[model samples]
Target: MSKIDFLVIESDAARAESVVAALQFLGYHPQRGEECLVAEESTHAWRAVYVGGVADAAEAERQFALLGAAAAQVPLLAAADSPWAARLGAAGSPFAQRMATIAFPLRYEALAEAMRGLYARLLGSRRGELRFVGESAPMARVNALIRQVAPFDSSVLVLGESGTGKEMVARTIHECSPRRDKPFVAINCGAIPAELLESELFGHEKGAFTGAISARKGRFELAEGGTLFLDEIGDMSLPMQVKLLRVLQERVFERVGGTRSQRCDVRIIAATHRNLEQAIAEGRFREDLYYRLSVFPLELPALRERLDDLPVLIDEFNQRLARRGLSCVRFGASALQALAGYPWPGNVRELSNLVERLAILYPQGEVRAADLPEKYRGQPQPEETRGAALLAMMDARAPAAAVAPAPAPAHDATLLPEGGIDLKDHLADIEVGLIRQALDATGGVVAHAAKLLRMQRTTLVEKLRKYGMQGSLAA
Candidate 1:
């Protein structure tokens, strides 16, 4: 194991010595509070902060705060006897909520277990703009590859299924590289028409073609001294591939319909969902271009291939939603089990969409297997069986007197009248009434109203459209 840096903030000499000894035994480098404070200007990121034997809560808070931003990014581990441990474990403060408490005497076994969990969490947090939120073996390998290739300016070819975050990997490489201060320009080769792609990549001079009214800088010039991400490179036409190949080889490109060759100093990072090798065999892609682009190949695994990462990914997505002022949602055990069983054809993107939709539908609610969409609830037990099991479990936990008898059916459950009724219209009317109430309660905010009714915003919008109530409601 590598030597992880830990900041130890303890006032008692004996306790501080014991803490440092245990950290060294666990193969971690421990820096004293005074030492860390003196080296505050250093750009070192501590893996965790150890708080033990502080005089009181006030002194502990002051010393912890003094560690500054370096301490803020990492985990906090407090001893059981530490004066501030109780306050740090309280619910109000966000930082305190995440702090871990250890044994007072600092038993190695307990300390190791706490450290293990925190280390895994620390690994999943942000690394620059790279939010690689997974600790699975596949993701660990991907992160290792990124670290190895980021220092060099070699061409990287990222391969993954659609929605598997190929472009994210490309951006991570750029963000981790030495040229991160420069711009990162991206162009989707497949999205642009063949005629316009050349001008999009290599700028056209003023009046060079029909619509070339003004000269514009292309992606190569825009990404000078940084990275140019060519997405869906497999879709580039044969002629365009030839032109791109020339630029890759010579590091120079001539604008469309221009004689002057402009030198480019940009790193090339290309990605595609298609199999370039298959495209080459089919004679649809240039083999030479493929080789040039794949100097360092990085492949991202589909979400289904790494199910262990589901929980972390969901938490990261919820944090993102919360940062945007949207409500965060939590999934119950059964809901998570159902989600794990799902085959995510759309990969990470689909999961992200589901989280956002759930945030809109459930708000700060705990979602169960039944609450999930039908497609996601894989092979769930019948409602009758589930209800019986739930009742049995409740009976086992609660006293006989505490369990109330079932209530009688309500007035709304009365039999239909003799006159034939339009069941569809009746149901539609009930839905409209509920929607109107939810809308009114939320002051016409569709998203908030959707949460109140436990439905998606888009679903509510469609209902409003079908009822011809769009004009009356504020969207």
Candidate 2:
């Protein structure tokens, strides 16, 4: 009885405009940004769906198959032009209908007629809700990988840039794996000091070291029958690598001060921003260890590379932030456009911090260019380090007759005085907004959401803690 949110993925502009309008007219809440968008702002379940701008018939069928595999129980549709007809039309009286050929301008009347028929069938379908959002390619891959790897126990290596969501990848794998019911232990291989890491991975007996006043169960032992995540594994020292390798090969390790070996069945999920191959070549990391950990490698894409997912990411961020009582956090079109142009070198973590800062400083509402950092306001991208002459040449020349319009009036500084806000506080607010936004955009699809906001999921998480908004923004 209620309206369903339809994710309309179009390959080109023509299909996007027409399909979205038709969906709207059919009483559906449609999300029409990024063509590669995977899910909605908060979930993986898909309601009624449609695809536009498909290159050809074969491609249309392939796309539909993919949707069927990923969307749980939702109906999928594609635009039907007159030449192609509705080749994949559903038969009988169906509540939801998929239109493979969408109506376009060539023969407006014919297209409209086809769309109306499809809409009528769609409205009769029973399926109504879905979850998991964002449209990033890496996310789709990750989703597929989760389904495949979760049922088995394979060492997973998550490799990516900083703020790219490696930990989230590890978590997703663990959640979907056979050990989902068991513990999911996470330890930062780089965060702990070299002296302590050895003992942390392999439990220490009483009086093992200065703090070993009592016997302790290390992470590996604690994660028995579950998963043990080693974040920033590339940072572990040579000696530690040897110790970890021994455990992986033999599946047994002795405590720091005890000679007795302990056997644990915990699966290892290691992640790092650095390249292990490079580290091995430099003699910093062991080749054998790298191979052992990287048997199933999943490389996450950076936020800059997946610009098509920005809108869904924003929606995902808003949903998570609302959970934390930051209900009014929102974004406007121009602001998002500004975000798309900026180079998010700091990645998703940087974006999360910026969002948190916005939630703290700006009112709960659409963020503007003025509210963003100076670096994003108009700063050149790292790739644009070349001369401005090239940029100028790329700009189209305006006709003399249509001379420029008058500039808008200057902004009044008194409304939110820059001088009054503490610089640290301001920065913190930005961080909070960015983190909150990233988490929400992916429907708590932490990794994809993190990429959308140009941050690593862990980095965003740390900022969430710093801004004291972690619990509030739980996925």
TM-score of every candidate: 0.57, 0.53
Quote the lDDT for 320 in model 2: 48
Task: Identify the runs in model 2 with alpha carbons over 4 angstroms from their true place.
Answer: 1-133, 379-475
- Tens digit of lDDT per residue, candidate 2, span 1-475? 3323566656676767776776666566666535433443344333556665655656545544444433544555555543333444546423134443544553343344344434323332321211223377867776676667667788889888998767766766665566755666789989999998988888899997887898877888868888899999999999889988999999999989999978889999899999888888899999999999988898888889877777776666654454333544555443565788877887766776667677766543456554567777674322122222222322235454444443332443225565464455445444444554455544556566566556688976665454445444546
List, residue by residue over 115-187, the lDDT tens digit for candidate 1: 7545433443543434566889999999999988998999999999999888778777876788765666788
Give model 1 RMSD, 1 decimal.
Answer: 19.3
Candidate 1 local Cα displacement, residue 386, angstroms: 4.1
Q: How accurate is candidate 2 locally (lDDT)?
A: 0.63
Q: What is the alpha-carbon RMSD of candidate 2 to the true structure?
A: 23.0
As a whole number from 0 to 100, the lDDT of residue 260 in candidate 1 is: 95
Q: Tell me, by TM-score, which candidate is best.
A: 1
